[model samples]
Target chain A: MHAIVCIKQVPESPSVGIDPKTNTLIRQGIPSIINPFDLYAIEEALLLKDKSGGKVTVVTMGPPQAVDALKEALAMGCDEAIFLCDKGFAGSDTWATSYALAKAIQSKAADYDVIFCGKQAIDGDTAQVGPGVARRLGIPQLTYVCKVREVDLEAKKIVVERLLEAGKEVVESRLPALVTVVKDINKPRFRTLIGIRKASQAQIPMLKPSDIGCEEEHTGLAGSPTEVVKIFTPEPRKGGQVIEGEPEEACETLVQKLMDAKIL
Target chain B: MAAAGTAAVRAVAVRAAGPRSRLKQRTKRYRLPNLRLDEENCTGCGACVDTCPFGALVLEGAVVRILDSCTDCGACVGSCPSEALILERPKAAGPAVDLSAYKDVWIVVEYDRKGVSHVALELLGKGRELADRLGCRLAALVLGESVSHLTDELFAHGADLAYVVEHAALKKYRTDPYVETAAQLIRKHKPEVVLLGATTTGRDFAGALAAEIDTGLTADCTGLEIDAASRNLVQTRPAFGGNIMAQIVCKRHRPQMSTVRPKVMELPKRRDGHKGQVVKEEVALDDEKFLTKVLEFVKEEGSTVNLADANVIVSGGRGLQDPANFKVIEELAKVLGGAVGASRAAVDAGWIAYPHQVGQTGKTVRPKLYIACGISGAIQHLAGMQTSDIIVAVNKDPDAPIFKVATFGVVADLFQAVPLLTEKLRKRLGK
Candidate 1:
C-alpha cells in the first residue's frame, strides 16, 4: 500500500489584515506554517502507513519556501517529499493548482493506493482542490472524512466516515481514491528527534511544469476560469450603545433592548 | 476579438444595475485592457477622465481616448452619463465561446425525511431574483430516492421548474454517482447558472461536478449578481476570514456555478398553493460502475452541532475565565432553547469541544440572535457571527471589539451580568 498526502503552507495566523491604502494583503512580517488542517492529513497518512506497512509521500504546490513545509512533514515520519515549485505555477487558483497536482501525481506517484488532503485550507477556505484533484484524476472522492474505519486491501477498498451537518455516514470506496480528512480524525503527532535529524539531511525532489508535462496556458493565473475582479476591505461594523452601570442595571437595559427589537 | 500586441477588448462593461460606487471592480493589472469608444454616444461629459485612477482615459476632441497605460479596471466605464465608455476584457482569457446556448438559472435542492433544507429554499429565493433580472426561468434540480414530494415545496418557495432524478444509489450522496448524473443533466440542458448551498454535501458535490463539467465554481459567495454587459454571474465572497472581499466572474464558462453559505441569503415565504412544472428524468446507471458505497449513518445524539441552523447561539470566550463558567452560557442557551458556542480561545483551552467553537476556524453562523459572553471580539470571531440579526455582548472591557458589532452591549462582569440577563429572559418568557 502506498499513501499520498497533499499539504499547503499557509500564513501562521488564519486572520489576515489588508492594507486599506494599497488595497493588498499585508504579508510582510507574518510567518508561514503547515496549514492547521493539513496536519491531520499528514498524520492520517502516517497512521495508514504504520498499520499496513507502506511508504507515505507528501506533495505541495507553492513557492520555493514551501520546501520547509515538506521538510516538516518528513519530520513527522513521511518517507518522501515532492516539491511542485515553478514560476509558471504562480497565481494558480484552485482549478489550476489542482490540475498541476494531479499531473504531478500521475507522472511521479501513479501507483499510489489512496490520496489524502486536509478538508480545507485556512487562507483560501475554499475546500475545492481535494475534490477538484479527484475529479481530474477520474477517481472517487470522499470529503470531510472524520475517521478511517478500515483498509481492506484484499477487497481493494477503503472505508471511512464522513462528518456532515445532518450526521455522520460510513462510506466505502475503491482503492486509488481520494479522501479529505477533517481535524476530528485524530490529534497530529509531534516531530521526533530521530525523524528531525533524518529530515534535515533528506534531499527533497522538485517538480516543475516541464517535468510534469503541463501546458503553460493551463497551469497559472491565465488558466483560471474565475477571476477576482475586485478586492476590498469589508465595511467595519459600527459600535453600538454600551451600558456600563451595575450588573443588574446593564442586564435590564440589555434585555429591554432585545424585547423592543422583538428578538426575545 | 481584441488584438494581442496592443490593448484589446475582452468584454464591455455596460451600465450598472445599481450605483457605480457600489459596484467594486477587479485587481489584476497584468494585461492591457482597452475600452471601446461609442463615438456616437460620447457627450464629452469628462466623467470618464476624472474617474480614471491612473489617468488612462483622456477627453480628446470630445471623445475619450484610452491611453496605453490603461489596465481596464472599468472605473471610467461607469462614470459616463451617456453610457459611451465600454470596457472590454483582454483576449488573454482564451478564445471566447458562444454563450447564447446557455439559458435559465438552476439550483440543486437537498432534502431528507424531515423535508427540504432551509438553504435550498434560500437559494431558490436568490435564484428567483437572478432569473427575473436575466429574464430566464428559475429551476431546481432534485436528486435522491423518493423526493418527488419536494417539488410542491420547491415551487411554493420560488422555483418555476423542478427536475427530479430518482435512483436508490442516489439515496446517499457519493461523489461519483451524484456528479455523473448531474453532469449529464447539465450538459444536455445547458443552464446559464447553477447555485448550491455551501453545506458539507453541497461543497463536496459541487467541486467534483464543476471539475467534471470543465467549468468554474466559486464557494460560499455572499452576493450573486448578473453583469448587465457580459450577462455573467458576478460572485462576491469573503476570501479569508472577513478582511478582504472579492467579486469573481466566470466570463467564458457556461453554467456558471457558485455555492453560497447557508443562512446568508434571505429565505422566501412559502405559499402552499404555488405550483410549477415537474419533469421526471432518467439516466443510465449500473451498480457495478459505482466505486463507492454507503455503509452506515450515525446521527449526532444531541442538537449541539446545529450551529448553522440555530436561531439563537450563546457563545463564550476567554472572558469566561474558567471552564466552569461555561455553565452560565449553557444555562442561557437552555433557557432560549438555542445552541452553545465557544470561541477558539475557549476551545483551545479545552473549555469546550471543537464542534462548539464559532469563528473563521470554527463555524460561520447567521443566527437570529447571538449573545457573546466574555468574548472580546477577535476579527475571526466577528467574521462568523457579525451577520446575526441581533447581537448582545456582555464583557468586562468596555473597549472590546465585540461591542462594535453588538446591537446591545453591557460592560459589566459577564459572571454577574449573564446570570441576571438569563434570569430576566426566563421570567419574561415564562420558560
Candidate 2:
C-alpha cells in the first residue's frame, strides 16, 4: 500500500492579537508549524504504512519555508517528503492550491492507492481542498473520517466511519480514494530519535510549477475565481458583570438575572 | 423536460460570457501584476507604495516597481494622485456563453429522512433577500428520492420556484449521483448564485460540485449579500480561527456559490399555502457507476440533541479534573434539558466523547444559553460558542478568559456552585 498524505504549514496562533491601527493580525512574530489537524493525517498514514508494509510520502505546497513542515512530518516517520514551492504558487486560494497539489501527486506518485488530508486547515477552516482534490483526480472523497475500519488491499476496498452533522456513517469506497480525517481518528505520535536524525539529513526535493506540469494561470491568485474584496475584524463580545460572592448568593443572583432577562 | 424548466425561468438579459471562458483564454498560469504605469504623468511621490499592504511596491530610482508579491488586490490603484497606476486584466477572447443568462438566486434545499434541515430554511430566508436585491427569482433545488412533496414547504419559506429532481439514486446524500444531478440541472438552468448549508453533507457536496462545474465556492459564510453596483454575490466568512472576517467575491463565475453555517442566519417565517412554480425534472443515474457505499449510520449514544441544533448547552473542560466528574456537568444539563459540551482539553484528555466537544475543532454552536463550567476559555473554545445568546461562566479562576465573554460570571468552585445552581434552577422551573 502506497499512502500519500497532504499537509500544510500554518501560523501557530492560540488567539490572534489585532493591530488596532491596521485592523490586521500581528503576524510578524508568530512561528509557523504544521497545521494541527494535519498531524493526525500524518500519523494515520504512518499507521497504514506500519500495518500494510509500504511507504508514506508527505506533500505540502507553500513558500520556501514550508520545507520545515515537511521535515517535521519526516521526523514523525513518513518515508519521503516533497515540497512544492514557486513564485507562481503564491496567493493561491483553496481552488488553485488543490489543483496544484493534485497535479503534483499525478506527476510524482500517480500509482498511489490512497491520499490523506486533514479535514481542514486551521487558518482557512474551509475544508474544501480534500473534496476539491478528489474531484480533480476523479476519486471518491470520504471526509471527516473518524475511523478506518478496514483496508482490504486485495479487494482494492476500504471502509471508514465519517462524522456527519447528526451522527457517524460507515462508508465503503474503492481504493485510490481521498480521505480527510478529523481529530477523533487517532492520536498523532511524537517524533522518534532515529526518525529525527534521518529527517535532519534527508534530501527533500522542492518541486516548481514546471516540475509538476502546473500552468501559471491555474496555480496562483490570477487563476483563482474568488477573491477577498475586503477584510475586517469582527466586534468583540463585551464581558458582562461578574457577580463575586458566596456560592448560594451568586447562584440566587444569577437565577434572578436570568429570570429578569427572560432567559430562564 | 430540463430545457422546458430552464426556458420557463429565462427572464434576464445576459451580459458578457461567464468568467470560465475568460479563464481558458489565459496563456500564463502565473504572471506579475499587469499594472499599467503612466510614467509620463508620474510624480514618483510614492503614495501608492505606502498604501500597498503587502510591500509589493518599492520606489526604485524615483519610479514604483511592482514586486513578485503583488497579488493584484488593486489596493494601491486608487492611491496615486496622478492616476498613474491601473490594475489591468488580460483582454481575452469574447465569452462563449452569456453570463447574464444565469438569472435566479438558488438555495440547494437539503432534506433527509427527517425532512428539511433548518439550515436549508435559513438559506431560503437569506436567498429571498439576495434575489430581491438582484431583481431575480428565488428558487429551491430539491434533490431526493421522494422530495417532490417538499416544494410546498419550499414555497412557503419564500422560494418563488421549486426545482425538484426525484430518483432512488439520490435517496441518500451520495457525492457522485448528487453532483451529477445538480450539475446537469445547473448547466441547463443557470443561476447567478447558489447557497448551501455548510453542514457535513453540504460541504462534501458543494466542494465536489464546484470543482466538477469549475466554479468558485465560499464555505461557511456568515454574511451573504448582493453588490448592488456589480450584481455579484458578496460572501463574508470568518477566517483565521474566527479572528478576522473576509468578504469574498466570485465576479467571473456564472453562479457564485457559498455555504453558510447553521444558526448564523435568521429563520424565515413560513407561510402556509404560499404558491410557487414546481418544475419537476429527471436525470439518468446508474447505481453501478458509484464507487462508494454507505453501510450504517451510528448516532452517538446519550446525545439526545445534536449540539448544533440544541437550544441550551452545558460545556465542561479540564477543570473537571476527571472523566467521571463529567457526570456533574451531565446532571446539570439533564436538569436544564440542555445538551453537554466539552472543551478541546477535556476531549483530548478522553474525559468525554468528541461529539460533545465545543470549540473550533469540535462544533460551532449558537444555543439560547451556554453554561461553561471549569473550562478555561481557550480562544478556540470561545470562537465556537461566543455567539450564543447568553453565557454563564462558573470557574475558580477569575482571570480565565471565559469570563470575558460570559453574560454572568461566578468566581467559585464548580463542584460547589454547579450542583447548587442546578438545584436552584430545578426548583424554579419545577423540573
Candidate 3:
C-alpha cells in the first residue's frame, strides 16, 4: 500500500492587515510555515503507514521556498517528498489549483492507493480543494474524517468515521480514493535524531507543470471561476463603554446591566 | 475566439435578465488600482492605450503610465502586446455563466427528528431580502427523510416556495447521497443564488456539492448582498484568519453559493399564516452508493461538548496554563448554569477535548452571556463568539484585545478574579 499526502505552506501569522487604498493584503515580513491543519494530515498518513505496512509520500505546491515544508515532512518519516514549483501556477485559486494537483498525481504519482489532505487550509479556509481534486480525478472523497476505523487491504477498501453536527458516521470507500482529515484524528510524533539526520541529507525532487502534463490554460488564474473584489475590516460598533473602576464596582455594574437587559 | 498570445476564457449560457439587468447605465464609485508599467519590458506599442476601457493608460517614450481611472480589470494587461503592463492580481478569471436561465434565491435547510436548526431560519431571513432585490422567488431546498412538514415552517421565515427532495438514504446526512440529491434539485431548478448555514453538516456537504456541481462557493460569509446593476451575489466573509474581511463574487457562475456562519444574520420576525408554494421531488440514490455508513451517534446530551446552542458559555484560554486551572472555569460555569468552552490553544495543550473548543476550527456560538477568562482575543477565537449578546472578559493584561469587544472587562488575574465574580453571581442568583 502506498499513501500520498498533499500539503501546503501558509503564512505563520494569519492576522494580516489590508491596504486600505488597494484593498489587498499586506503580506510583507510575514513568516511562512506548513499549514497548521496539514500537520494533522501528515500525522494521519504516517499512522496509516505504521498500522498497515506502507510507504508515505508527501507532496506540496508553492514557491521554491516551500521545499522546507517537504523537508519537515521527510523528518517525520515520510519515505519521499515532491515539490511542485512553477511560475505559471501563480495566482491559481482553489479550483484551478486542485486541477493542477490532480493532474500531477495522475501523471507523476499514479501508483498511489490513498490520497490524504487537510480538511481545509487555515489561510484559504476553503476546504474545497480536496473534494475538488477528487472530482477532477473521478474518485470518491470522504472528508472531515476524524478517525480511521479499519483498513481492509484484502477487500480493497477502507472505513473511517466522519464528524457531523451532533453525531458521527462510519464510511467505507474503495481503494485509490482521497480523504481529507480533521485535526482531532491524531497527535503528530516528534522527529527522532536518526530521522533528522536522514531528512537533513535528503534531496527533495521538484516537479513543474510541463513535467506533470498540465495545460497552461487550466493551471492558473485562467481556470479560476471566482475572484476577490475587495477586502476591508468590519466597521467598529459603538464600543468604548468599559465600566471604569475597581473589580468590585465593575462587577456590580455588570450585574446591574445584565439585569437591566433581562438576562439574569 | 481568443487572441493568438492571450489566454482563452470559457463562455457559458449567460444573457442579462430580470428587472435590474436593464439598468446598464449604472453609476458607481470604485477604487482605482495603481498599475505601474515596467520600462524594461515595454515594446513602445500603442496597443495598451487603445485597449484601456477606463482610458487610464498612455505610452510615453518607453514607459507606460496609468492614469487614475484604472479599475484593475486587467483587460489591457493581455492586450499590451508587450509584457509592460502588470497588476498584483492574476489573469482574468474566465468562466461566463448564463444569467438568463437562473432566477430564484434558494437556501438549504438542515433538520433532525426534533426540528430545524435556527441557522436555517436565519438564512431564510436573509434569503428573503436577496430574492426581493433580484425580483425573484425565495425558496428553501430541503432534502431528508420525512421532511415535507418543514415547508410551512419555512414560509413563516419568508420563503416563497419550498423544494423538497425526500429519500430514505437522506434520513441522515451522508456526503454522497446529500450532494447527489442537492445536485439534482439545483440542476432542475437552476436557482441564481444558494445559501446555507456554516454548521458542521453544512460545511461538510457544501464544498463537496459545489465541487460536484462545478460552481464557485464562498465559505463562512458574514455578509451577503446583491449588486443591483449586475444582479450578482456579493459574498463577504472574514478571511486571513478573521483579520481582514473579503468580498468574493462568482460573476460568471449560474448559482452563486455561500455558507454563512450562524448568528451573523438577524432572525426574521415570524409572520403567522404566510402562505408559500410547496413542491416535492424524488431522488433515487441507492443505499449501496453511500461510501460511508453512520454506525452510532454519540450525542452530548449531558456533556458540555456542544457549545453552539449554549445560552451562556464560559470559555478559558492558554492563560489558564495547566489542566488544573480548568476547575475555576468549570466552577464559574456551574454557578452561571452555562456551558464550558475553551480556546484552541488550551485544547491543543491537552487540557480539554476539541469538541469543547470555540474558534474558526471549532464550533461557533451566539450565547446570551459569554465570559472569557484568561483569553486574549485572537481574531480566530473572536470569530466564534463575537456575536454573543453580552461578553464579559477577565484577563490580567489591560492591553489584551478581548476587552475591546467585551461588554464588561475585569483587568485582573483569572485565578483570583474568577472566584470573586462567581461568588457574587452565586449570591445574586441564589445558586
Candidate 4:
C-alpha cells in the first residue's frame, strides 16, 4: 500500500540562461523548481497514500540543492523523503539517469509497493526515464497515465487509464508497478501550515552510489552512451509583416499576402 | 550486406598500417558496442526482453543477457531493472563518418487526388537549402502511377532532379509496395538526407523504408540543420508535450532520414520556366505485395479546415466563458476567412476538441495572422502560435501576455469586440 514518488528539479527557464560557449545551462543564480509534471505524480501518490492510509515517500536525484524540491514534496504531505546525491551522478542522460534511479529504487524495493514518476522531465524531455526505470525494475509500466481508475490493494492490482492518440485505454497491472503520470492526472495540493512545519523539521535520507549499489562507471556521464555534441537555442522567430489598416483592408491585405506567398 | 563488406574491406586496409600510424589508423576504426548487462545487479526482471524491438535480451539464470545481434539502439537499456543494462561508447573509437556513398538530398513527394501535399514543396525548399550547403543535387522521388506530369512541377518548385517510380501498386500509400519501391530507389541512388512529411501515410511509409534499410529515422522534426563539422543532418523535434526540444543525429548511419511536420517549413516558390532532369524508374509490383486492399475511403465530412495550412487563425480561450460562446469567435473567424483555434485550457474544459487547441501541449501553429480572443497567453499556449506573422489580441485584461506579442492590442471585453468585429467584417464581405 506504500507509494514512492520520484521527483526532479529543473531550471525555472523564465529566469535561466544557457552558456553559449559551453552548450550547458547556466545554473548559478538561477531559480530551480520541482519539474511541473512531477507535481502531478506527487499529488497522485499523496492521493493514494491518503486513501490507503499508508506513507508516501518522495525521492529525487540531483545536487545538494535539490533538497529544496524534496522539502517541497514533504510539505505537500509526503511522509518521508530520500535524496540520491553523489558527484558521480552528474551529467547523466536519460539512460544513465534511469540506471541510477532504478538502482536506488531497488535498494529500497522491499518498503514500497507502487512507484510513480512524471511522464517526462522538462529539462531532458526524453520521456524515456520512467519507461527505462520500469524496464530496469521489471515492473508493469504504464505511461502517459491520466487517471487511476481503480486500485485493489488486496489483490495487488491497479487499473490505470492511459492517454493515447485516439482515446484512453484502461490497463490493469499488478502492484509494484511503475506509472508515469501526465499533467492532467491531478492538481497538486498546497502545503498546510502544519505540513510546512513538519517538512521544515523532516530529516531526508541521503544516499550515495555505493549505498544504492550503482556502479560508478554506469551511473553518470561516464556511463552515458549518447552525448550532446552541441546544444544551441534555435534562431528566434523573425518578426513578420504587419498589415495595419481597418479590419476590411487588413483582411484584404492578408488575402493578397497569402496569395502572393502561394499559401492559398 | 554488400555495404557492410565494403566497409569492412576499407576498415582492414586502414588498420594494416604499423603502430607509428596508430593515431591516423585510430581515426577510421569506429566499433559500436553491444548493449551491456551487469548480471550481479540485475533483478531477473524480463522488462528489457519484452521491450527490445530485436530479441537482443534474454533472462538467463537470474540475470538479463544481451544477444550478439544487438544493433545497440539502446531500447532495452532503458527498461532494465537494477539499472543492469547500459549502452556505452566503445573506447578509442575513431570518427565514424561512412556516409560518403550517399551524395544527394532526396525528398519523397507525397501527392493525392487533390494534388501534392504542401509538405512536399516545403521539403523541396529545405532540400534545396541542404543541397546547396552540401554542393549536391536536390532530387524528388515521385512514386505513383501517372505522376510523370508532376515532374516539371517538382523541378519548378526547387527539385534539380526527379526520379519517377510509376506503378499502379504505388498509386495509394500502402506500406509494402511503397517501402519496397522507395528502398529500391534509395539503394540505387543513395541520398545523404531523405525528407518526408510527418503525415499519416508519410510516417507509415517512411518508417517501413527506414526499417527495411536499417537506418535511423527521426520523426516529427520541426527543425533541420547540417552540422558544419560532421555534415550530419541534425533533426530537431519537440518532445515530452513540447516541454523541451531534442536534436537527434544519425551519427553512424547512411541516408540520414527525418520526417518534418507539415506547415513548419516554407514552401519553395515555383518558377514557371524552371526545368530539371527527370529519370523514369519502374518498380515491379504485384497484388500480393500490396495485399491490403482499400475497402473504402470514408472521408470525414464537415467544414474541415486544413489548420496546418491555414494562413490566419482566430483562437479563443476559457475566458470565452462557455462552449456556446465559441460561436462568437467562430463567426469572427468565418468573416476573416480564418480557422478557429482554442487554448489548451479551453480544450481541456471541453469547450473545443484537440485540433482547435493552440499551445505547447496542443498544436504548434505559424499562421500569417493569429487573433487571440479572451486568451491570456500562457507560455505553453504561446509556444504553439507565437510564430504567427501578425498577432492581434482582444482581451478584457489589459495586461494579458498575448498583448505583448500582438501587433494590434485592444483592451476590451472580447464578447463585445468579437461580435462587433464580426459584424463589420460581414458587412465588408457582403455576407
- The DockQ of each candidate is 0.26, 0.33, 0.27, 0.03
| Candidate 1 wrong stretches, greater than 4 Å | A17-27, B1-97, B321-324
Write the residue-wise lDDT of candidate 1 on A152-215 in tens digits.
Answer: 8778889999987757899989988999988778889988877777776777655668899898
- lDDT for position A54 in model 2: 92
State candidate 2's TM-score.
0.88
Assess chain B of each prediction and give its TM-score: 0.78, 0.81, 0.76, 0.72
Top-scoring candidate (TM-score) = 2
Among all windows of ten consecutive residues in candidate 1 chain B, which has the lowest summed lDDT? Answer: B1-10
- Estimate the overall C-alpha local distance difference test score of candidate 2: 0.80
Flag regions of model 3 displaced more than 4 Å: A16-27, A165-167, A192-210, A235-246, A261-264, B1-85, B88-95, B301-303, B319-325, B334-337, B360-368, B378-389, B399-401, B426-431
lDDT of 2 at B400: 95
Report the lDDT tens digits of candidate 2 across residue range B1-431: 00000000001212211111221222333434455577787788887765443345667687877654354545566678888887654443233247789899999988876778899999999999999999999999999888888888889999999999999888888898899999999999999899999998899999899888878889899999888898988899887667667788887777889999888899999899899999999899998988999999988776644787788899899899999998899888988788999999999898888878887777778888999999989888987898899999999999999998999999999999999999998999899
lDDT of 4 at B81: 54
True contacts kept of 1: 0.47
Q: How close is each model in CA RMSD to the real structure?
A: 9.5, 9.4, 10.7, 16.2
Measured by TM-score, how close is model 3 to the native structure?
Answer: 0.82
Residue-wise lDDT of candidate 3 within B1-431, one digit each (tens)?
Answer: 00000010101112211111212212232222435677788887766664442234656686676643343435466666677877664445544556689999999998877787889999999999999999999999998888988888899889999998888898877777888888988998899999988876787678778777877788889899999998989988765556556677887777988998887798999998999999988778888866666666766565455576667889999899999999899888888788899999999899987878787767668788999999998867886777788898988889888888888887877887788788888988898
Model 1 RMSD, rounded to 1 decimal: 9.5
If both were scored by TM-score, which would come out higher, candidate 3 or candidate 4?
3
TM-score of each: 0.85, 0.88, 0.82, 0.58
Residue B383 displacement (Å), model 4: 2.2
Q: Residue by residue across A1-264, what tens digits does model 2's lDDT show? A: 899999986656634554559544443334456777789999999999989999998998865445667777888899887777665665567778788889999999898999999998776778888898999999999999989999988899999999876789999999989999998999999888777677767766657788999987776666667776666557878889899789999999998897787865
